[model samples]
Target: MNTPQSMMLGWGSLVVAAGVSFYYAKKTINERRAVQESMGQRPSEKLDCASFLLFLHCL
Candidate 1:
């Protein structure tokens, strides 16, 4: 493929991957929030920086 075509293909692939990643991340967050609600926890509770980091690490 020519340089411009290859570059377009590369950028398109990156955009698609990013879109899929964002979709899944949002879905996972929603699922987790539901689980928290089911467990009697408030999903709307705010976490401090360290706690937020720990939560992400646990994931």
Candidate 2:
């Protein structure tokens, strides 16, 4: 029952949201890495491993 224009609008909004999420995630990861490097630590490790474990347990 949907028109082509409606479908295009939905897809366009999805693409824009995905693009914004990618940009913010990339920026945040870069900043975290910079902070870790400055502290002489590995940038690849989780910053809250215990919290993650607790969250998983709750889930």
Candidate 3:
């Protein structure tokens, strides 16, 4: 064929960029899941404590 090395370099760069993007995307999703789990627990725990305190105060 004998076209150009620049075309090959451009394709290689695109592949590397895609790999990096996929890695960061996985990491971000994992972090979000962990945060959502922790945030989901906090409010119920606080409500439980508040309800217990109110029950004792009623006596």
Candidate 4:
């Protein structure tokens, strides 16, 4: 692909990956919160953005 097309494709892939990661992270946080609530414990804070970004980097 030409330079502009390559750049666009790269960015598009990154956006899709980030969206998928965020979806899974949110789902996991909700599940964990539910488990904590069921056990009479308080729900912890949501996962931090830095951690989420690191996760994306690893993928």
Best by TM-score: 2
Per-residue lDDT for 1-59 in model 2, tens only?
88999999999999999999999999999999899888989656665988888989999
Question: Could you tell me every candidate's TM-score relative to the true structure?
Answer: 0.64, 0.69, 0.55, 0.67
Residue 2, candidate 4: C-alpha displacement in angstroms:
6.2
What is the overall TM-score of model 2 with all chains considered together?
0.69
User: Is 2 or 4 the stronger prediction by lDDT?
Assistant: 2
lDDT of 3 by residue, 9-53 (tens): 888899999999999999998788778778884342335788899
lDDT of each: 0.92, 0.91, 0.82, 0.90
Q: Write the per-residue lDDT of candidate 1 for residues 5-47, one digit (tens) a residue.
A: 8999999999999999999999999999989889988656778
Q: Provide the lDDT at 28 for model 3.
A: 100
- Candidate 3 — what's its lDDT? 0.82
- Full candidate order by lDDT, most accurate first: 1, 2, 4, 3
How much does candidate 1 score in TM-score?
0.64
Which stretches of model 3 miss by more than 4 angstroms?
Answer: 41-59
> Could you tell which candidate, 1 or 2, scores higher by TM-score?
2
- For model 2, give the 10-residue run with minimal summed lDDT: 42-51
Q: What is the TM-score of candidate 3? A: 0.55
CA deviation > 4 Å runs, candidate 1: 43-59
lDDT of 3 at 46: 36
